[model samples]
Target: MSQETLSIAGFNVSPHHYIGGQRVASGELFDLHCPIDQSLLGRISEGTPAHVDAAILAAQAAYPAWSALTAAERKPYLDRFAAEIGKRADAFCQLESNDAGILLSRMKHGVIPRAMLNITWFAEHALSLQDRPLETEQATHIVRHDPAGVVVIITPWNSPLMLATWKLGPALAAGNTVIIKPPEWAPLTSSLLADCAHAAGLPAGVLNIVQGSGAGTGARLVSDPRLARISFTGSVPTAKWIAQAAGANLVPCSLELGGKSPFIVLEDADIDNAAATGALMYRNAGQVCLAGTRFLVHSDIRDHFVAAMRAYVEKLNIGDPRDIAVEIGPIIHPRQVERVKGFVERALADGAELLWGGKPHPFGAQYFEPTMLTNLRQDSEIVQNEVFGPVLTLQTFDSDAQAIAMANGTDYGLGGVCYGETAHATAIAEQVRTGFIWVNSFGIRDLAAPFGGIKRSGIGREGGDWSFEFFCDVKDVVLPKKPFRASFSHR
Candidate 1:
């Protein structure tokens, strides 16, 4: 491939499946295009069930040596890997921004740096894993943590590297050999990750990358009995299928699915701050799982909140992602743009008032304007479903109780935000059903805290000690109080 046709992080790129520390080619190929201009990015191998089997067999073969190493022995490799990523951070960010249609500014300043921090944080945290001892009068019990044999991590295209590292950092630190299946839409950076692993001197088969569509490669990997566990981040419908397949094999799986999270603005909230944070609905074109897509403002200040939010979104620059000044960029693909437009069109037909920017941008093929809608019914499809685009739905709540009820009404319980006075926000946050809540702010994440959701959003946590535990199994050893004596005379 020529540099103009297939370039990633300033390097001419050709995609291949990474297995047993070697880049392997397949008979079939799939083209990946840049969403910004629909330009040809590169071609990736279309992995088959046979490829999945090979990746699994490679991971299984590497498990013994990889797992036998103590955390102290493993930390150096992880540290080196983090350093390698740091060296190429700028290039990686640009590649990701172009490949995923995220703004270059956000990718360079926010996502890429955070991904590096994730690797470093988990590398050091691995050393803190210590056995626990429970002492009792009759017996003493000792608990040990052991790595699962082979783990499969499947990540979505929205935030491919960040989400993949969220699982990979801890999974590798816990000493499990892994197979990473990046979504077909954005798999470029993941291939770069495999390169970094090799440069860090990781053993063969310790980390593998398999590139293919979800239905073909994803299903095969999930159903494989050799897989010790699976960590997946994607749509709820796909998560359900993965859960069923993993369940049949009696393997544990961690799912981080979709969200239609609520952003509640109280009557006494600081209008400026609330509006600023609420504008996060347009961040990454609102494709984030934690994006607060539903707005439930107190009726007394609903008008003020709507006006402020509109002003904030109107000032946002929407154009080519490569432009550093652009705040909102293209959707991941043309199909996704159509899906977002469908949601807006249905809301208009259902009698919701469109405040601003509800149609496709005339400047680009895959661009949807930042959209705002008000007076939407609480049970309406647009209000209840995840648009996964730069779209926001506005509604009003009569009281604090009503706000809490509306916040917890959705099937999702991933993330939420409450804006008001400190004590008032705290009270409302306590009643919210989501796994994580932000008070007076949004998108502030601490790597040390556990992150996951209840209800249908997800099943298992994915940060701090929770991530370490997810890739490991616990074993208990009990000791008798005293030595036993021979009792042959009793017979």
Candidate 2:
């Protein structure tokens, strides 16, 4: 491969879809660009409805054999897939960094490694499945978990590979074949994932990749009656559309959507650590769905917390993502930059105080300064909506109840953080309406814990045994007693 081209598994794979264990070109193609420098990365095959149908057909064909394999039998293949991904860790990190504009160092140390761990974890989880017995006086009953065939996984661009693994890991572990529709902006890593699966000797059509826009490939996949389930991670609006389409076919769906999460700093909290953790609002250019963009502080320590947060945000290194030293990279694209900017401008118009940076970074066209806002109404758009940018809004509350109320006020209930005395924090964490809450921490995640949101954030969970249930259908079987005793009704 030349500097201008990207190849996967020794194949010059520009402008093609990985379907039925082969790379096939489409009649049309879409240009992929590196957001870091606005450079053309390459073209990817523009997936159409016909392409989606082909991928679905392939997955359906492969499902019976794949699902028939025992958990013990499937472990080695999944383990080998993890091993292949580990072998190409550096390549994956670089590709994802270039494609998504995330810091290469972050990808190497965080995202890519997590992707490998996610696959291995789910593979191990598969072995733990067992049938449950239901007690009965006159009959024997057993509940079995079975695979839901032909799962469609639609992943978002910000953390594509990691999020894909969140869905694919269990979907495959539960013995379902998958068709992955990666966001067009970040399709390379997923294609490479298919390559890894192929090299690991995964059966053909067991895993397929279709690359295109949501309006094209994603819509078709959700509408396909052959699909048993759909797992989607993206915006709330898109998840709604996916749910509607899946509903038409009565397909089971797990959606992990957007968030306007909250971070509360109480008077008794460790101000220094709280500020450091709260600064995660700027991580991934604040593209993370679990980001704590809303800050609720106790009025007693509000000034001190604001000062600490401002100092921390000012020190974030904004530069080329390829540079390992840089902390903040470019936004995903120019449109995202504008979208983030619009949020800030609207907040200002709504009388929110611009206490810190609020404009594009002076160094890059797609870079926005980590912004901080204060004195905003709780119902303001900036506080209520998902900014999905390097922006944070601050408000002070008089009491614990007030803080909890403010945190739960938004339509989103994805993630929340409570920082203070452990007991107090834990108490508040329980009251927050979000699906996941942290006490004194911000972004800590455990694979064993359920992860998803409530309200407008999303529907259904996606980790631990929750994922197992989501990808599997449960059936109850009852066996009659050998004596076949009949009950007599009283006159």
Candidate 3:
């Protein structure tokens, strides 16, 4: 293997499509650079429509046998896949960190483990699933979930492996083969995922990887009629395109798109803890879709909360992601650095006050300071749009109703936070338009809980039984009573 190649599980990680358990290095290759320093990482095989067709063919061929297996029978394969991922956790972490400019420590601690847990949980949970049996006056009804056919999963650059496996686990557990189109910006870990699957002896064509631009590769993937469903996590604009394509084929889609989530702090909230939790939103340089970038605080305690948050934001050790001690790292890419700068410039132009860091960090072209904006109007571009950078907005509300209104004002309703005494926070949380809300806590997740958003955020949910339903086609069967009496319908 060359220096560009990463060998995991005796397989050299190539920047090429893995179709039917073989490395298909066809087509012209595109260069992948490390986000941390813009160094050549690998030359990815540019996926073509032909590549997509091949993947579809492979999935079609594998679906029959894979779906025929019972949940109990399939668990061993998924278990082994998780074991393989565990064996190469270090590589997964390092690759993801280098590829995304996220802290290696963060990936080591959170993302990779969650990816493995995703597989583990779905594998075990699938075995315990029971169809609901209902007794009616004249008949008995049974609702069963049957596997949909081959599905396509389009993932985002930020937390690619975790997000992909989040959908992949249930999609596989529900007995659907998959074609994953990892973002070209960070395609390394996904290729490694295919390697892990292969190492686990997952049958050929059961899982495939395609890499390339969204305009061609992604567009072709979601539009394909052969896919039973399309699951995507990315920007809202791209989701609209995916929806249009999926709609043309009438293929169902599960979209987890962008967010402008809010974190509210009432006067009665624990200011220090609230600030700490709010500061955590800047993780991964604010690349998270569920990040609560909009902070709303009670006017009575606004000044105090701002000071607390400013102090906490300063404590973050922004440096190279390779350094384990660094808290915040560079923006995912130079383009994103400019995006944050544009937002900061426009925010200041819109008369917003810069309470804390806003300039590019000294480390390199990609590094950015964690920025916080105060005195921002609700109509500001920085307030409504998804910055996808280490920038945040701070606003003050007079009443609970005002807070809820301001929080719900954005086009997104993904995830939100309400910080206050338990009862008040719960009350406020209930009024926000988001799909999920936490009272006093941020980033706390329950494995079985459903996660998605409303409005422009996204459609459909994923997790637990929700994932089962989304990944499988549920049908109801009606059985007549033993007497087999026919009854006339009355209207």
Candidate 4:
């Protein structure tokens, strides 16, 4: 059965079903846990080595038929796929918000539209595939783009539906069959997506969903010899493990990993704008890999930025994610809350002053107030490590060189921001070692441009064209039979 055909409750009715030649959910079991309340969502059939073998077999069996379909034929499937998603869009959003502990407003207003746009972007790009022209001096030259066989997309829980679409959209647009492995913490949205795909009349084996832990199922998907490509988004440590496994199998993999990005406020930057933009660091409870976790301010304007930032953090409404005005929700889980607390405690121990919202929320239970810590030492853990929560650390720089140094000192370079006028911020953004940089904003992204981290942030690009390119192989054919070629050697 396809993910699209799954039950509304989010469990695969027959996780052990066979597609093409592969078997899924034979003897494996995976429990989906709600990150919001730590309740059990449901259990999916666990994927084992034998199951992985079957999936590879199924993908290989279906590849030729799926690939042979013309772009026009594939176009309808995409339209139907999107329609299916639209059918249960509300259910999907609710599940995603619940699973990620993100506000429903953000999910409905931000994530869903982006997910739909991703699909539309891929569909539009699919029709414009023009082959490269050969030089007149050559008798014959051809450049063809072909799909990589048997792709595996391993997605994280943070933005389950949206992130999965990022990988799925381009992979399918480029005509690759994919097996998606949803994160253990949030499989509900994926299950709904799978259902949509099936209802859209996509071929049974064209898309599959396998649920399990990163250790077993993730390893199996990465190590399987039949997979030609793997696209993964998660922590750096997990990306490392995936890279190693993919290396052993000699398969190409694309990774979107961790980040400890910085936001630099120049001496000329408007303090109010910088402070307001810095608040985005706490978006999604600061769980985003590209969140601007570090603040590098000009010593001249540092105190003003800190004071305004403290006031903003204090004013945030912290409560249930379902509440409309709740600016800050509970973290994905209590464990994440504890992790953020540990970071705060460590920062205080290292002599950082709590500027605002240091303690847990007065309402209690998995919610932490939006927090800002000033007087943070340059080398303190709060400024160094990624504290993926509603916490921002303050640091001041005497010179532009010091700002650059502090920003680049971390292992991450996923994102950076410079707050100033157009020309100056653009120049500074150019110097930051990051895949994405904004002049006055922090986390804005467009589907047209490629998005990925530099350094430890990630290893590959994701977007419409960039993602399609990642899933394709280029083959060049040259013929030297033309009259203009004196040396007829074909390289």
Candidate 5:
């Protein structure tokens, strides 16, 4: 998001399916639980297959006009939409905090601004994107970027507003109408986002959000044959299902599935600096896909690094997410808390050391402690899989090669971090299989740089022109410089 500190106020929430720029309520509904206190946030109308159909039709109807507009022509709508969201940044922050148990400060500082940034950035980038032209004696060939038809964006709950816009910005900038399916747990933001678009005077059916269970609503949306693109940020199984569904229609897809990314620390690394960065496993309560949950430290400094991490994590204020001063908050869901606890329990049974914080905090079952584990076997289930919590596992490596090997061993190759002298750390980072890495820092975002993953972590790159590339189709058009003779006569 944005690095600068900004003031937050408040915003309104809507309850309905945003179709054709109108609120359509449903008889059937689902419950939204607040993870901070395990309270029922509210009951949201469930989006059925019918709702999905309506949204798809709405998007299809809007597509002709939206896609007909040039990227430059489309920029005004994006700009106004961003302006609407910016005005409600404060209220958006509080609602997200209440809805998803994220620290309010984090939502303000690291997440909310991203919605505005994503839309504005992609709109500008689309304007800057140049078409490829090749000239020959006979003709000139140009590769033109055209909008894909209607798009379906399935966003994850961990960072709903930011992640949804991550795909939404490019999809809209490329002049495609979009339908978003927000995770049932944190569905409010998407509805509110839809309201923002409507308030910004966006045309009816240009941006739609359908909310409900993945099986009923999401399954129906992806299975539709009219989709031109499907961009998903979620689990592997769901992405696999999307791939299959899209496969049937020959529809293109981009999946940003979560990662079990690794963070490698060399013997020469700065202990305090490395520890502080590693402690960020607790950021966003460690629900982030790019979190470095696995720590591969040098054997000589493993103990010291773990000690420093424990000190850093312990100081974090863990409680109600609405509290501006709290550094850590609850896990997004109750089952996720139990799942995180289970991973640590299994590791403990397998002889892993519990360096610190293994169970639910005194706050309740919904809040997990900032957990740390060491003495883990590299082949163990906990070591090899994703915990998706405030859990950190420490594994010592005897050499840089071994650290890189251990880091690359996971099926995930999303984001990795290496810490040491610049050249040495960068040398090791060069061999790491992940799509992106930082030598001594963490979460330094560059929207112009390529971001995504290799292996099972994800399928494509995004940001800058890459986003335009995915959301737009390239068609070669050739024009003869002079009148052409008949081919048969030339033969």
Candidate 6:
């Protein structure tokens, strides 16, 4: 290991972090760096197939006690965990902001606080247990929610802690043992989360973590027969692989993948309001999964919308992650920066006009200027793919019906936004085919709502009680007064 490598609890580490029952130190290694400065952060030993096996075994071993404990028993641990997280909130925010190239101010004020809130939400949700009831002629029956066996949680680099907590909190609160695989690119917060749990006196082996890429570590975890469920947040290609593995093992899996969500600016929409709200696409440098990359504006107001958007993007300050005033940070990696640039180039070649920003940022390795492209072909790669960068493609539609149709034309149906007069936006929202749609807003998510995608965006759901169902199993217990009936209709 070089000076760029970090020493964690004695061993030299990579950007990736792992926490198996016994510490591991083998297999491939990945370099972690700051997305803004490209400075080496650390290295993590990429786990092998053997490592995944060991992790699954450890999780299986820990399941009994971890699942057997009552909600009352688990409450204190997460409560303490949340308190500790709050204590070091500043450090956690700083680490994530630097590593992921997220804006320091937003990370400190928005992302970090929301992550902590997720922990608190789960802690409180654990205390309240509610079940649905079914009525019958003879008697009443209730559906009981019980924890599934072992759970495999795979979280992506974008919004690492917040997304991980969304799965980790519910899975743990539901009493299922968990095995987490943090992204190699952003493992600091994941390690910090494990540390938080450890400091809160969580039992060893209850929440196991292994560091590695999606190919070996994550794939093996989902495929392991010991796992009863897999909760994953990543790309669509990887989600398909996880789904295949889960099917092979006959285990349930929940996936939340990429999106090319549309943000429609209706004819009657307030141009200023729409522009301001759509600016969130550049937030976190557009690394968010639910970012609105497709801007569909009604042709009647297309020119005005584009002008407002251009002005908004040109004003965004792009630079160091440490800058308090800088709203847009880097792309989180050189590869991503290159990918975003490539898309812009392709758009240019395909006859799309660059409305404002679209180039290597003046500052860092991962930085790309907030870019806006108009007159883009609907068939262009930039319009079809999820360009996870601070870039947006503006498209126009003749009618509200046409806008909704175009918005839902892709294989993805993750999220969308409708901006217009109150009545019109609400009307458009109804026709937009997405799991979540914002009225006059973009990228707004809540812990209480059901969050997920439709079609290619990914399957199943996350957040609220919906996620809890993924890690639970239902058993039908019947006590009949007469002999059991075999009729299709339970008469």
Top TM-score model: 3
323 in model 4: Cα distance from truth in Å?
2.3
By TM-score, how accurate is candidate 5? 0.95
Winner by TM-score between candidate 6 and candidate 3: 3
lDDT of 1 at 106: 84
Ranking by lDDT: 3, 1, 2, 5, 6, 4
Candidate 4 lDDT (Cα, whole model)?
0.76
Q: Candidate 3 on 40-155: residue-level lDDT in tens?
A: 76777888888999999999999999999988888899999999999988888778887877688888888878999999899888876646788998888888778899999999
- RMSD of each predicted structure: 2.5, 2.3, 2.1, 3.3, 4.3, 3.1
lDDT of each: 0.88, 0.87, 0.88, 0.76, 0.86, 0.78
Cα lDDT tens digits for candidate 2, 1-491: 12334663244334577889987778777878888888887877888888888898899889989999987788899999999989888778778778888788898899877998889899898787756788788777887768989999999989988999878888898899999999988888888898899999999999999989899888888998999999999998898899999999999889888899999998889998999998867988889898888999999999898889888888899988878998989899778888999999988987889988999998789899898999999999999999888998999999988999999999999998889999988998999999998898867888999999999999999889999888999888888767676789877
Candidate 6 — worst ten consecutive residues by lDDT sum?
8-17
Compared with the true structure, the alpha-carbon lDDT of candidate 1 equals: 0.88
TM-score of 4: 0.91
Q: CA shift at 361, candidate 3, in angstroms?
A: 0.7
Q: Give one digit per residue, the lDDT tens place, for model 1 in 1-491.
A: 21223566576444888899988888888888999889887778878887888999999999999999998899899888888888777767777887898788887888778888888888788887756787988778887677988999999989998888888998998899999999899988888888889899999999999999999988999999999999999999999999999999999999999799989999889998999888777978889989888888999998888889888988888888878998888899888988999999999999999988898887689888888898788889999888899889888999999999999998999999999999999999999999999999888888899899989899999888889789988778888788867687854
Q: List, residue by residue over 1-491, the lDDT tens digit for candidate 4.
A: 22323343343333333444234444556555555556665556766776666666766777888878765678788877887777676777667766667787888788777777777678678666535547665466666667777899999877888899988887887778888888777776776676677778777678877777789888878987778899999988898988998899899989998788888998888888788878867777777887787888889987788888767666777676766677777777777789999999988887888877787876656777778788876677888788888888778898878888888888787887899777877777888899888888766677878899888888989875677778988667766674563687889
Error in Å for residue 414 of model 6? 0.5
Each candidate structure's TM-score, on Cα atoms with residue i matched to residue i, is 0.96, 0.96, 0.96, 0.91, 0.95, 0.92
- Candidate 5 at residue 51, lDDT? 88
Q: Decide which is better by TM-score, 3 or 5.
A: 3
Off by over 4 Å in 2: 1-14, 134-140, 479-482, 486-491
lDDT score of model 5? 0.86
Q: List where candidate 4 sits over 4 angstroms from the true fold.
A: 1-28, 134-140, 479-491
Which candidate would rank higher by lDDT, 3 or 4? 3
> On lDDT, who's better, 2 or 6?
2
Better of 1 and 5 by lDDT: 1
Which residue window of length 10 is worst by lDDT in model 3?
1-10
